[model samples]
Target: MFVIGIDGGGTKTIAILVSSTGEIVAQATGGTSNPNSIGIDEAKNELLKLVHSLSIQNPKAYKNVVSVFAGLSGIESPKYKEEMKQILQNQLPEIAVTIDNDAVIALFSGTFGEPGVVQISGTGSVTYGLDSKGNRHRVGGWGYLIGDEGSGYAIGRAGLHAAFLEKDNRGPSTEISTLLLEYFQVKQIDSMIPLIYGERARTTIASLSKIVMLAADHRDQVALEIIKYQSQQLGEQITALIQISTFQLEGKIPVVLTGGVMNRSDLLLNDIVKTLKDHGINQVEVTVPKLPPVAGAVIAAFQAVNKNLDKISFQNRFLEDYV
Candidate 1:
């Protein structure tokens, strides 16, 4: 039997086809699958297109794919997952389908199947934790308007707030505004205000994330604060999950950091590690060469169907090194 792993994100989707022995026969990427950002029809279409593209990449392996594991971001409710499961099932009735939050997959990839916590920084932010027994819990991911603390939106919004504060003499006048504008080649701040107020601005604001990186590079106090603050939020999320987990993950679970933010800057991840260490997390270790989250989604799907993550480590290493 073959396993399919998919990472469904806000902006794009990645699919990897793996043989039972852990060889990645094919991989494909496509447009975003976030239902909140892209309508369900568009999301489903993109998913179908990507999934089909995966099979098309290797016709021989496609016939052997017996199970599918997909983890999607922006799906907050069990109802949403069930609905998505139905959709995927309808598309391929013979294949078993499993769905989970995008962060869970990230955690799996980050830790290579060792139970742990994951912090994802993308258009949004969410922290989730899992234990040895496969129990899962989460924090954040409320979306851009309400929560999503430390996400791309949150970071970009902080950048703009710092700029405006500097402009108004109430906050630090930093190079972020100029840096952000330069990143987008915008002529005026007000221009962004209007664009950000509109639908397209969400995507536009995401592009502005470079401004945050630039600020951190230049040692801007606010930028540093933002990065550290976000790390703290993630740490707090991990701490909470660790505290509440029923499986007793206090000392052994690996702490995995993932997503765009974790990859973009080691600064934030270092800060998070330091903070956690300061709080007495000695078993802390980093998962190098991030495993694609879709692998975890695939693992989740497999586990959901068979109710076992025992081979999770083997599958993770297979795909992580498979690439």
Candidate 2:
């Protein structure tokens, strides 16, 4: 029988149709379905609707599907997962549905449920680890107010603050200053505060992260510095995950770079890799997850698939949707 996987995050919800043999037959994309952001009711409705739509598209094949695996961003607590599973089971009574936090699947996706580190950077940020012995630990992911450092919001806020600092002659001139002004089409830093705080101007501020990345790519010193800081922070997260891990490893554990910040910015990713090596953790084997996290969800759904974890490495060669 075939299987399905769903990855629900703050930015987007992704679903993948996987053959029992693990090849991707089809995929569908939808808007944000984070239960924390969009309430549980809305999130559930959106997820079920998307799944139903995809299932119907190829009913002859999908009707044979037997299980579904879902990894969501906000369902961290057991109570949350239980409530979500009940809602999902009610909607998909015939199919076995399992729910887990998004980070679990991300770790599973890379190490194939083995021991290693998976660092995720999306609307927010967190680092997760699972050792060979089934132990798990996590760091960061406290949210925007206290944590979520090196995230898009953090990057954008840094750029904006730097711009205004230069505008008032409080800090040295930075490329972020010029870039932010140009991005917002504002003349002065003084005008930016009110503009950003305005209702209409609220959503566009996060877009500044792209501009910040571009500034660093062009060798802007301040932007590069910001990226370096983020890289170090990310590296530190991995270090903490490894240090706190209870898994007994024969050697250095592998590390996987997942999420937007690691995948998007070479400055940060490379810096992280270098930091690992510098710390003498030479066993780092960084592999890009073959499937978007939705695919990871599908894999998680097969928790009872009775297969060895290490045998399926999620390498580029793996997407074989078996009929």
- Which has the greatest TM-score? 2
Candidate 1 local accuracy as lDDT? 0.72
TM-score, each model? Answer: 0.82, 0.87
Give the per-residue lDDT of model 2 (tens digit) for 231-316.
Answer: 77777887777777374566657677777655565667787877766776677777667656666676667664643333454433
Model 2 TM-score, 2 decimals? 0.87
**Candidate 1 C-alpha RMSD relative to the actual structure:** 3.7
Off by over 4 Å in 1: 20-22, 35-45, 74-80, 90-95, 184-191, 245-247, 298-323
Alpha-carbon runs more than 4 Å astray in model 2: 198-205, 245-247, 307-323
lDDT by residue (174-206, candidate 1, tens digit) is 778788667656887666666577766665665
